[model samples]
Target: MVVKIIVSTDKRAVKEENGDFGFILWEILIVVFLMGIILTLATPHFGSATNQVWIRIDSANRARIEGAVQLYRIDVGVYPLSVTDLVRAPNGMSEWAGPYLDEIPINPFDNAQVYQIGTMGQVK
Candidate 1:
């Protein structure tokens, strides 16, 4: 068996069949209003999620710096004078096997300073 489909090219007939063929002003306004409401509800959640992400990043960076300091102490037999020592060899250390880190990571919470190393090779 074979089936055939009939198509209409008449503008009036198509418009009448589809009943206006476009959104009215009230329909467009309703869509815009719904979108605004959705955005209003979602904005606060986005801000909180961003803050959570920053907190996690800060924790990971501190841990990484602390590990590097420990490695430096193991290799050179002394804790670094500062975080910068991880990226540069300190004076009079023949066994200084670093730039352990390519560079010290900046503290996200405080853009003005990088993470600090304490006396006992911990991140401060």
Candidate 2:
């Protein structure tokens, strides 16, 4: 759609063929500028919201790992020495009814490393 504007006191078309082409360009520029401003103002909030979601996801993962550790201890009568023991049955342990976890969960903050377990059967 093309809009024609009359910039005269009499409100008559100044040039029908041209239709104030420069004015249209200026209008487009103004719209783009407004969009930039909006994006700039909104970007920080969006980033913070994304971080909050990651925190929640990691918190739940920590709880899940802690629960698995507790179960492992209850069955084996001691905390596993490492996180991997949750996902692999240790040798020479008859009471070890694991793979308590299907696999060690990766730390959300560090994808390459699995979550650590504390000496007292806590997930770190």
Candidate 3:
């Protein structure tokens, strides 16, 4: 078996002899930069979506609380003294419709500096 090898001195003949790595590095940097921008742009959208979901969850919880209050009102003659009163007995009652709720729901918007405003005024 005989092997033949040809060697060339032409600088252009060598692959990546001039500025190849630089261009590739630049391309990679550009791609990385573009990805960072994409993520940056998408961050607020994710936050907005999360906020919307939180609002929905909070609204549902508030509605459930209101329903519990209404049930308490029906059982009693009038509205309770406060939100906590709905979960507790009115005192001097032999029997009542409830234990209306298994447990009192917590205000979901407690964090994030959020506030809840009802018809009368700020409830929580």
RMSD of each: 8.3, 5.7, 5.9
lDDT of 2 by residue, 41-67 (tens): 999999899889888888988888788
What is the Cα-based lDDT of residue 24 in candidate 3? 49
Candidate 1 C-alpha error for residue 21, in Å: 13
- Output the TM-score of candidate 3: 0.68
How many residue pairs clash per model? 0, 0, 0
Each candidate's TM vs. the true structure? Answer: 0.68, 0.78, 0.68
Clashes of 1: 0
Candidate 3 on 52-100: residue-level lDDT in tens?
Answer: 9878987877777677767776777665556556557767864457777
- Candidate 2 achieves a global lDDT of 0.80
Provide the overall lDDT of each model, using Cα atoms, as 2-decimal numbers. 0.85, 0.80, 0.65
RMSD versus native structure for model 3: 5.9
lDDT winner: 1
lDDT of 1 at 41: 100
Clashing pairs in 1: none
Model 1: lowest-lDDT 10 consecutive positions = 4-13
